[model samples]
Target: MPLSAWRLRLLIVSLLTVSFLGALDHTVVATSLATITGELGAVEQMSWVIVSYTLASTVLLPVLGKLADLVGARLVFLSSLALFVVASLFCGLAQDITQLAIARVAQGVGSAGLHLMPQTIVGEVTSPRERPKVMSWIGAAFPIAILVGPIAGGLITDAWGWRWIFWINIPVGMIALALAVIAVPHIAGRSGRRFDIVGALVLGVTVTAFVFAASWASAGTPGTGIPLLIAAVVAIVGLAAFIAIELRVSEPVVPLRHFANRTILVCIVLSTVIGVGLFSVVSYVPTYIQMAYGVSATVSGLVPIATVFGMLVSTLVTGSLASRSGHYRAFPIFGTAAAAIGLFLMALLPPGMPLWVPMLAMGLVGIGTGAYMNIIVAVAQSAAPRTDTGSVTATISLVRQVGSTTATAIVGGLIGVGVTAGLPASLDASTLTPQAVAASSAAVQAQVAELYSSVLAPIFIGLALAYAVGIVAALLLPHGRLSDELEPQPVVGAENAAETATA
Candidate 1:
């Protein structure tokens, strides 16, 4: 029987809740990092707290997605939520950074499942025609979480404590768990396919090495270049091995044939490009605002809310339009172009422009990004064979995460080099905080602003270039209406028999 309307709505709400909680974890913890490190007395190892979760989550994404395909999404989703709740409890209770980091690893495992399974379930439940609308709701969770998390984190951390950041998840997790248990149906996979353990290992190693290299590069601590280089080599070798193994495996964790599909490949590329642009802006723009305008951290943090608001509006509008028209290629094409224009406009902003200028530019970028947020995933799932849905979805997630990490590393390098070049010999780059900028003489402030603008211009230009690449990819996307029917799995026996008959 088809799912009832009310049931479908309930299921979506449940999934969105899971998605929000998973997405919120990173931003909230990031905002509370200082407090966390201070209370735990592990300020020197602060990066590990965030890095550990990111590495674990990135490594486990495909593994958990494969597990969902093997066992069942309902089982996986519920179990992950339970694990997240338990991990959150431990995180809140931790007396030291080591324990907190360990707990975060567990949380990352849950987060991986939470992030991957909900979208997979959305694909399972909705017809391609309706998927855009449903997926828009799901996709909106991340930006909403991004918008709310920092402010909430600051408030909660200030009023209560950093532990409350983790503690807050417990209630949300419980609610999502209850709703999921009631609303989500069990989605069973083929029983005969063997798990590809070797492929999983290789892929994990490749992702870990790549992520470690990017993290080190972004950290830019002196003497880390050699380690980064070594990681890059390992990542290259591991990725080659992974591809080789996947090609030979009967049932691979990631189906090699998906890459052979031009449409799928293009969608993946677009996803990565969008990820780079979106996350780069989200991660660094606030810092840019603080430095350029000498605003309080709170005010600068609030500036990104305009972007998130724009995203929310565009997501709903474009998603509905795409679903109604049963076409999606236009969304990405137009969206990417809009994003590129916005980014270019941002790059061109002169120092001491009106405050609304950057915020408006960010809003434009958000609108462009939002238009394709869930549409690309819907398109990829629609294009792939039913048997490969989980794998395709996981691959999209993996590529996007890698893109975000890569963008962060690239932007960090650009800023680091630019600051080093622009700052005078007498000025220590470490002392160039917003507070310091505010305290400096008028001449000093003007000089710093000019230097900052010069550095930021290139970063924004780079962002525009990424979106421009996305625009090309989007233009190249195959024009096909979303099929009303669910994707069909291939029949191995029938294919073999047909081949024999032809011979």
Candidate 2:
């Protein structure tokens, strides 16, 4: 077989490694975010640190998938890896928040491919049935990397420096790239496919506008509210125009029609719902702990490893079970139900509860998350045609990002509202660091902590509701056995694959 030399295990490791790098960078700075912003003298701009990378990555995900479908996944992967490594170097060297954010944007562009290519590549070499097993290993990397980031960031910042976090990507990315080049099979792109340049451009602007509008609105920085409104209007208009353009174009950046499929529609809805809640929990809980506990970033980061641990257990168990049984629908339904319970418990916690309480609650959510995302993705991919793999995967990722971005905004807004109404003047909610809060008067510290916990409680409650909705969505997923064998490739495409890899 053409894929014999590719070594399935090695290919899985290589893809996981690449995806892990992207996932790591997207979140590595989170635990150290306050520290990074404090040092750069732009604490007010802190959310931008995460938002910039997320925004850039969110917009590019589907576009890169389309490009890979047109050119080659290997070519896109290699180029993206090279770009990510270089951008990381600049991110580390950045002297100011602006410079750091700009570097992060470049890094995000590369991150999009790193996050997307593994899903795309798995489609290349493995049967649909095999992917649950392989993706269980590969897909777990992104979530694990995301969860481990705070711990990694805290530990690194405690010992080395925050800058080193970005710098570390260079060596790891290089190794992943080298391994992929040596081990991964080349899958040829569709012949004579016309790239949808115009549609792609419109999509980029639309996504950017929506993300920024959400960011600005969430921050609630006085003068920025109007800009957010303007951005929102632009985003709405862009969405309408982008849809119109995509429909008119011979080859749309996103094939909107595929969205009509019940499986695709349900999977996307699930992605959006799960993505909103899960990404919010992953992004904010550590920050919440750091602020409320007045603990160092290291300790704050450590607690969330339980989330990583829980996710680890679920992904391995569910993935292995689904692969052998060829049944995946139950996982998402069970997972979302479990996650909703955990989140509800999170919302119900009393003030001044022990640290371990949150650790447990968040861990439960992780368990649920681990089961749902991978299974949902596999089901969606299985339902789509073979030729539609990359776009479909990209669409899933893009929609998930959109959900994440929306959740981020909603969470941030909730916190902002709390700060405005209840926070004392003595406490600067915008620039809170664990170290700074520790030095403040005990009364001020307690007030700040209480306010934060109060605000976060509702956010969790809201997320619990979202996951509850996901349960119904998951139930709607199609239940049929995925194919046990790989779909046969066209003879011409198969022959050109090796040639394309070399070229």
Candidate 3:
């Protein structure tokens, strides 16, 4: 029987709240990171804020998705909501950067469940035909989040303080929890098989080893290279172990067998590459604007709207065209090229350029990134067996997370190296807050912009080159039609969803 209107409303509220919070945290800290690091006095470890949240959440995506499948999303979502609320309290009370990073990691564990389970919950409960309304609201959260997260982070940091950005989740999470208990029906577990604890542990350790190594090296701490080398060896060993474990396990985190399909392999490669640059922009750009252009956190928050807007338009229009035509290859092809151009523009941007210049550049990037946002996942799902649909979806998410992990490590290292070498002792990472930059004379501001441009130029160019590689992968992707009957839950993950809806 269909849920009554009242129950349905409560259910949708819970789902949207869960999704929005997950999505919000992804970008919300972008504007707040500088201030957080500044206040906490750890300039070199600044990327940990984004790195920890993203890395923790990223590695756990597949594991959590599978757990939801095995145990039921309702149980998982409630547990995750409770964890998220408590972790937020920890984040608010954190006494140091390390403490905050640790809290964010715990928070990310909850976010992993909160992010993926909503769609799963709704899928388990609702009739397929009735989903679009709920799904659209869920889909709407991505765009709204990208808009609100940074702006709200900036405002909250400027006013009550950055800790409130986290503490704020407490009330919201509690409300969602109440509404969910009142409305969402219990979904019994789908399978009685043992959970893949080994697979999950192996995957998590491998990623953490790799990210820690990269982040440590990026910090430029003396005498740490040996430890970095050790982390690298551990990552290699852990990856081997993970592969071995997966091949032997009954239910793998990501089945190695799926790579046998040519289309599946191509889809994974393309998704991984696009994902490398897709989310990292939000991680660093606002901080870049604040540090380089002397913009207030509020204005910095507003900048990503250009990229999100571009992605939104491109996703909607291209999704519609591909749906009607069933020709899905062009979006990735053209979209990647456009993103490359946008990055090129950003890389070559003159110091002291007008705000609109970067805005325009990011818009092109959005246009480009939006092209492949949802289509790639739809194609992958179509190519996989229906029985393995959810796992396949989660695996794709895992690899994309891997890609972002790579981006953050390499890019974060580059920034750390640049700041250590190029920036003078007078302008420590903590000292480069918006207030400090704003107080500087025009000549000093221009000088800092030039220094920032030089440091950031290669990173943008390098990301552009990454997109160029994605274009090559997209070209190699077989000319396949997107499935008419896609899994009702999004495989695009919670990052962006409505693109598939337009189809």
- The per-model lDDT (C-alpha) reads 0.83, 0.80, 0.75
Q: After TM-score superposition, what is the CA distance of residue 194 in candidate 2 from its true location, in Å?
A: 1.5
Task: State the lDDT of candidate 1 residue by residue for 128-197, as single tens digits.
Answer: 7778898898888888888888888999999999999999999989988999999998787766779899
With a 3 Å backbone cut-off (N, CA, C), the pairs that clash in candidate 2 are none
lDDT tens readout by residue for model 2, 1-503: 42663488788888889988888876678779988999899998997898788888888998898887777788888889999999999999999999999999999999998988888888767776677888889888876776678678889988998899999998988898899898777778876978998888888998888888877877777899778889999899999999999889877889886576667777888888777888766757777887677677767765568777888889988988888887777888988998899899978876567888888988898899888677767666666666667887899889888888877877877787886688878766567566777888989888878877788888888899999899998887655666666762221222232122111
Residue 284 CA error for candidate 2 (Å)?
Answer: 2.6
lDDT of 1 at 110: 91
Q: By descending lDDT, how would the candidates be arranged?
A: 1, 2, 3
Candidate 1 lDDT (Cα, 0 to 1):
0.83
> Per-residue lDDT for 1-503 in model 3, tens only?
55788888888887887788878976777778888898999978997887788778878887877776677667878898899999999999999989999999999989887766775665555543343335545545777788887678988899999899899899988988888787778766667887889989988889888877866776667888899999999999999999999989887877676676655676788777766776655568877777676777767755688888887777767666766676677878998899999998999987667788888998899888877765665566555544455566677677777777667767867886786577644566755676776676777677777778888888899889888988888887665444344344333332222234223
Q: Where is model 3 more than 4 Å wrong at Cα?
A: 1-14, 26-52, 89-103, 119-139, 154-164, 178-190, 287-302, 319-327, 419-447, 484-503
CA RMSD (A), model 2: 5.6
Residue 401, candidate 3: alpha-carbon lDDT: 74
Q: After superposition, how far is residue 346 of candidate 3 from its true place, in Å?
A: 1.8
Candidate 3 residue-wise lDDT at 434: 60
On the 0 to 100 scale, the lDDT of residue 268 in model 2 is: 87
The full ranking of all candidates by TM-score, starting with the best, is 1, 2, 3
